[model samples]
Structure formats: C-alpha cells, structure tokens
Target: MTDISLEETIRSFNNTGYPFPEDKTIHSLFEEQVERTPHHIAAMFRGASLTYRELNEKANSLAYLLREKGVRPDVIVGILLERSLEMIVGIFAILKAGGAYLPISPAYPVQRVQHLLRESAAPILLTQTQLISRFSIDPDEAEVIPIDLNGPVYTYPTLNLQPVNSPHDLVYVIYTSGSTGKPKGVGVEHYSLVNRLNWMQRKYPISLTDTILQKTPYFFDVSVWEMFWWSIVGARVSFLIPGGERFPQAIIETVQTHSVTVMHFVPSMMSVFLEYLRNSQSDIQRMSTLRQVFASGEKLTVANVRAFYDVLFIQNKTQLANLYGPTEATVDVTYYDCPMDDSLLHTIDKIPIGKPIDNTQMYILGENGELLPVGETGELYIGGVGVARGYLNNPQLTSERFILFNPQGLFLQKPPLDPAKTPDNNPPLTESFKGVQGGVFQKAHLLYKTGDLARWLDNGNIEYLGRQDFQVKIHGLRIELGEIESVLSRHPLVRDCAVIVKQFSQNITLIVGYIVPKAENVSSGELKEYLKNLLPEYMVPNMFVIMENFPLTPSGKVDRNALPDPSGLFGTKK
Candidate 1:
C-alpha cells in the first residue's frame, strides 16, 4: 500500500532530541525574567495591569504566607478561582511556595470539586471569597485560604524565596477523566515543563512587545504554557474575564486592543471562531494582529484549516500551527506550521501533526509491538523530557498506561520500573522521566501510550486518526465515556446507561446518552440537571435516548453498532 519502509519512517518522525538541564525548577527561570524586566507589564485583565515587579512581589507575599502554612515541594495545594488578577497571582504564589498547584475551575460541580480535593490529599486550598462558600471544607481535611492578599500578605517580605523543588518534584497536578469511571490526577514535574517551555520558546520565538491572549481554562494542561510562557520572555499576557473565552467578539476585541500575537484554540472552537469571523465583516478585520494561532485538544480537520484561511490567513500573514499531544505529554509534542501560502488548500487535504518538538520521540507501534511503517495506522507512543510523572496516587492505572517500549519485541510485559530501583517511595511517582534524555532509553524509554490512533506520513509528520478507546474529544475536552456512563448510571431512576459520541457531516459531534430507566419515567431535563451536579457541563450528554432495552451481541455485550442513530430522531447540543 505504501512505498516508505519502517526504517525510514522511524528515522524521519523521531527527532534528534537534546538534553535539557534536569535540575531546574519552572519558577527559577521565571525569576530570572523578573530581574531583567521588572517594570514591564507582565499580565493584563480587564483594564487592570501588573508589571513584572508588582506581580512578583504580590506572588512573593502570598508565597511567604503559604510557606508558613507548611506548603513545600511535592505538596498539593488546591486553587479554585475565577479568571482574575488573583488567579494569576495565586498560581505563581503556589509555585514560589514550593507546592504543586492543582487548578480547580470555579465552574466545576461541587461533587467533582470535592472528589479532587479528597483524591489529591490536598492540605491547603487557595480561593477567592466569592468561590470559598461554594465548597464545604473540613478544617481537618484541608485548610481553605481565601486569596484576598491585602490585609497581612503585604507585611511579608517581597524578596524571592529560595528554591527547594527538584526537577523531579511535581509543578502541577491536572485531573483528567479516567477510563476506570473516575478522574485521575496526572502530576507533571518541573523538568518536564521546562523541556516543554524551552521547546515552545525556541520553536515559536515571540518578541517582548507581542501580547499573548490567555483564554484557555487553567484546569486543562494547555493553559500551563499560556500562563507561564510569556513570563519567561517578558511578553505581555492578556487574560479574559471569567467565561469570556466563550464569546468570539470579546476574543477578537481583545486581540485587536492588545495586539495579541499568540493564542490557542481547540479545533472545534477554531471552527466556531472562524464561523463567527466569516459572518462578521468588521470583526474579521479586527483580528488582523494575530500572528500565530494554535489548534489543539482535538483533531485538526481539513474544514478547520480551510476556515482559518478563508477567515484571516488569506488577508493577513497569520500562521495556524496544528499542535498534537495528550495532557500526559506536557501540552503538545508535535506541531505543523500550516503553509502560509494561499495555494496550500489545493495541494494539501488533511493537515499533518508535524514532527516531534525538541527532546521528544513519537513512535507508531503495531498491535504486536512491531514498528509501524509509513502510512500504516498504529498506537502512538510518546517519549522524552516532556513525559509527565504518572498519575498521582494511581499506581495500577499508571502501570497500565505508562510503559517501557521494547523496539526489539513486544512491550515490557510488567510495569516499567522495578520496585527496588525506584528512588521515590511512591512507585507511580517514580516513572523514569529523565531516562529519555539523548535517547539513552533506545532499548526502553519511559513512554506514554496515547490511546489515539496515528501514522507516520511520507515526509515525517504524524497523521492523527481518532481515539482507539472510549475517550472522545469534544470542544477540546478529552472525555472518558465510561466516566460519564458511571455517573449517569448512579441516578436513582437510571438502571443502566451507555455514553457515545455521534458525529455527522461538517464536524457536528455530540455526546449521546442511551439510558434504560429504572422508574416509569425519568425526564431528560431531570437527568440533565442531576448530571450537571456531578460532572462538568461538557461531560453531560447533549441528548438523552430513552431505550426500552439495549441491543446486545452474541456475547451479551452492548452492540454499539446496533444502537440507533439519533441524528434526525433527536435534536440536541452540538
């Protein structure tokens, strides 16, 4: 079917990764930027602004207060806040205090928030006064600190705190939906973030005058680079008001007002944003200042690429880079800078998720663990410095997903690490993150088995197909169907349920919940409201199907293929 061989594909896709200084912390690098440009505006929200010096001093004040509260390296401190100056201040404060800040969005359901707090073993939580009352916090379980830093915070010294976190120490823990019907925390260490940030800075060099629009929610790992990237190079970051990301006009206005040069969008949102611009004549002209637009979280489709060019790229010299990776692999691993030329549409059909960034390796492996040749679809295994420490407090799940690959044979049958060789007492936290440096782990590298299907194209770029499992990406959210089904089945009137994604033409993807009710009747409205209390709004099915009985296969498994197509039968959210 294809001319390219296995050897050529492997050599082309995998980058010659270099070693990064493994002993550095994320904040230490940020501190250097502060000394260089202390008075430059670091972040802007609404009309309020903070210079590098002011932001640093405020973060330092909170850091001192947090340190006194026993926050230290590897300690998980919860931060639940709406988008504001305090939200930015709180994130830096947690890092400066030598703690991994777990980003908990204010939009999260109370039950979901409670689960994260409990599962993470969080000791201290930082939140605004408006958000603190939403959660019923136990003093013994976790101490809650309302993030109003005016009263006593200013009394503490504004000097930078001495570094304590090691390269191995976790900088953040992002909770993603788990296939096992629960949310699992993925702890990313400092070195991994440093590698990701370094690659971003070098590959896409933005000037000090360039302003980056920070709109993605902090709960997602995409926001990690958005929050910290500008600080390193002294670039300005423009933050949107809470929930402002949903408004296209606001985003365009912000870009035009700030001259925002860099920003990111989920592929679905890109379509929505482009669609908005297509309909609006004036708004499209206002978005001319955008330099590099990033597309991630979902598949970068042909339509998305076309929409980008039709809306802005053709008129302005804006570049749309399709970035691909899982949250497990620090934000993004591969990037394809879309050809700025107008002729790209006629020549190229689907955009390829480009080659691995610096210090990263992408391998396409067959079912039997053989190296997949060019054009052959296989599971994508990512390795290198960007790989995070496995899920926090989830050894079994960590062992299942993160494994050492054997290029010679089948994958290592057992867990990647030996108990005796593990330096950390916690086995899950001891993944060989630094092993991939300079390809030392050619025999066995610590790689995250991204369940997404992909293949190596002729010229070295990787083409993402779709998920190999139950996980689906909707509006840039990586959702586990099992997690949704688990929550749906828990309803008092629901007997059993199956969650699936329904896709039609023009990228109309919707979450569909097929339920067999326990009671005589359970209204769709009732089910929706109940699920909204337990799961995030996006996880809730856009439509509900009341099935008398689910069609099953010979083995008594729910035959998803036999499930009715609800396209015309029901109208629901897109």
Candidate 2:
C-alpha cells in the first residue's frame, strides 16, 4: 500500500450479502436432515451404531436432564469422554439444552484440566463414572453427570424441547494455544459456526451414503466441523478409536472397513500418511475409496501436494482440499482445492489457501490497519458472520486481538451496518488510516486479527506465511521458519521435517532442523549443501538433527515444544 492512491486500486465487496439461513440453529438444521433421512445410520463407534431417529431421541432425553440442571444459552458445560457413542450424544444434549459444550480431553494432565475448568467456571461436567478418577475435581467445582449414571434416561420422553436460544448464543467455547499464559477459550456463536458449516456443505456437499471419519480430537476446533458437518448433510460418522488418529495404517484400515469417504489432517500428519501410502501397496489400495482428504492446522507443503497424486489420488477422484483459519474465526475461513495436473503445479510452487468462505470478508492489512497490496506480506484480518463474539472472561486480551478497522480498499463502500443504530460501547471511529481520503469508518464492526502473516496472490488467493509471533529474529534478520521448513521438506531423502530456533548462549542462537529420514540417514554436510543451493545462507539451519519420528500433539499437530535438546547433535554450524 506504499503511499499508493486509493482511487487506483479496484474496490471490491461492494455487494456482500448471501442467502444464508440467518435464523437457523445447528440442531435445527440437523432436525431437517433427520426428517430427510431418519432411518440412515447417523453414527458408528466399534460395533455399535445409531440411526438418525435414535440419535436425536437419545440426545433429546439427555437434553431434558441438562435443561433441568439450569443449562441455557452461553452456559459452558464441561465434557470429558473418550471416543464413543456417548461422547456424540453428550455434545448434542448440551447444545440442545442451549448450553455451550466445552471439550476436555481424558489424556490431558490433571493440572491443565484443573486450569481449564477453573478458567471456564463450568457448573456441570459430563463424563463417564470410570473416568471420574482422572479429574482431580474439588467437590464445589462441578457436578459430574455420567451419561450411564442416569438409568431413567431411556425411559424419559424423546422430544425436541423448544429452547429459548437464538443464533447469537454461544454453541461451543473451544480452547486453543496461547502465549502469556495457558490456552485461551474462544467462544464461537451459533451463527458463526452454522455459517461455516453451511458454507462448507454448499461448497463440498456430502451425500447420504458418504461416511466421514471423525479422527480429530474434540479439543481442537477442526473437530467442530468434523463432528457436525456430516450431521447436517445426513452423512454417516465413523469414529476412530482414541489415540489412533496418528497411525497411518489404522487410518487406511478404517477407510477400507467403513468405506469412509471424507476425512481431515494437519499437514504434518498428512505428510506422514502419504509416505506410509508410498511404502505399502495394500495400504494405498485400501485408501483409494476415500472421496476427499482435507488438510489444515498447519501449512501444506508442495511435497505433500505432489505426493497425494503419486500415491492415494492416482486411482481415485478423491479431491484434496486445504483449509486455513484460527479458533477465533470459527474452524476455517479460507479453502484451497489442489489441482490434479502437473502442468498446473509447475506454475505455482506454493498452493494458496484460496479465497474467503461464503459471506465472509478477508483482508491482508499492513501495520496501522491500512490494507496491504497484492504480493505484500501482512497480518490477516477476518470480518464477517463467521467471526466469534470474543474470548471468554478475558476482556483485555479479547480487545487486543479483536479490533475495529477500516481497510483502504473498502473505505469507500457502504458500511456493513448502520452507524447510528448500533448500541455497543466500543469507541466511535475518530482517526483515519494513512494515505487515504477520509478513511474513517463511521460504523463500528468487529474483526478478528488472526496474527497470521499472509499475502494475496495474483489470482485473489491468499498464501499463508506462518504465524507473525512465530517468526524468529536472528542477528537482526527476521526469518520465517515455514519457509525454511518448506525448502527442507523438498529434499529427496527427508521424510518429514521441522525448523525451530534454540537459544544456547546469551548471544548465540541456533536454527535447528529436525528430520525423520525416509529409509537411510543422510549426513549433515550433504543436507547443508542441498539447502545452500536453495536457501539464503542466513536462512539455512545451523545444525541438522536426524530422528526416527517427530513427536505430535493429541490433535496430530507437530509438537515443536516437545522436541528434544539439540546439544551435542551431529551437525555443522555456519
């Protein structure tokens, strides 16, 4: 935007309204699907399965009890359970009772669990009796309600109780990784979650026969869509056993046995799965039944894109989509479809996380809230029906992340809403952004500052460049770890890789590359020589550490914090 005149660049989004169901609740849409396919198998875990009618009735029975316990709109109910039929039932029951369900993993440390519970201030916890020992719960903390403990639940009437909940009420408050403290609770409203799910259904519509594998843990936001996306479309859900999400062989067998059509992955785990496909012929053939493979949570590498075609995608029409978003802006806001042709991949080495979802507005803005031009890297800001209300119980932190801004390109267009009719206490626009004529926005609208660095491509797609906070400054040179990792992942011998900065001495910081070799290990000198030809000398890692595997989080993301110390490792320092 370097002092460029606003009149020169084309101003888009002049008309940004869609025919989305503005008033429908998530369960309301699911009810419609239930009417369409009541006899269809709605969920499957192990040998047990539930039809649409049976699931709704069971959820309604539990919902009756939740409402009796004073569950209402915006009420957070703690849910801790392993992957089972009851887990899905509890989620629906909480939502049907007009309460926002908060997921707590059974594998979480007791201290972290206590912290989340304390921060959330939940009054009720849904869990199994056997798992009650896992939580170090104080008597006054939360009233534990095990699904099986209530023997009369099946005898209770199975009817959809009319809840006093509106679309603006909170449906789920998911926790995400945060700095300065423990994980932050991102409270997403029913409207935001419904819009993302509806838009996804429209773009990539799932059929009644399609089976979506629910492998992602409920703690992460990606599981939000994985759980509900199919429920609305009347698609069957095949639940993966607890902790089996990281195993590629297990995924293949699940897909083959259940005829799973749709699934998702974080790019790190996707890379691992694709390599496993290449090594085994039976696994690759079994994975051929997949209709779609979704990648998100981290940057999708070019190598991962190419490997999809070489193995799993060669025999089938399974489309691979890349999704990008944070917990604050719902599960996902931007999506990309990987092209199948080699000629298409030749022109673009980096695949773009293509355009905003329906009725959503995405802007790449520079410092001071001014809009950055194409090809210039800047912070990504999301504004639309998809943006969440704000962080729960953290006003100062929420205000810092969610902001009001008037982009240079959109300043001339009509505001999303009326300025005089608004009633919020947020400050009225008083200042103008630089290099714009009257860049003040009279109307107050909230936008989530993702803190993610991205740039707009020539085709109106966005190229995600990692997190702004994750960028490391070494010797006055700011470096993007994703760029280094992307280049390192391109090497022929590397199976999977990650680049992290380690501080050893007061003045000495080293860039460390941790890699899982394909078959045989390669020496550090050879890897350094390969990186030298592709990357700048400063961007190359100071040391390369070969490893058997990269440790992953419960949600299947590479846990960089758990990487072992690189001291005394085999490598050369520049």
- TM-score of every model versus the real structure: 0.91, 0.77
Off by over 4 Å in 1: 1-9, 19-21, 149-152, 407-444, 504-507, 567-574
| Candidate 2: RMSD to truth | 11.8
**Sequence-dependent TM-score of model 1:** 0.91
Please estimate how well model 1 matches the true structure, expressed as its whole-model Cα lDDT.
0.83
Worst 10 residues of 2 by lDDT: 426-435
Clashing pairs in 2: none
Candidate No. with top lDDT: 1
Which tens-of-lDDT digit does each residue in 321-436 have in candidate 2? 99988788888888889987766666667978877776567888888767787788999988766778888899998989887655534533322333444335222322221222
Where does candidate 2 stray beyond 4 Å?
Answer: 1-16, 149-153, 407-444, 471-574
Cα lDDT, all candidates: 0.83, 0.78
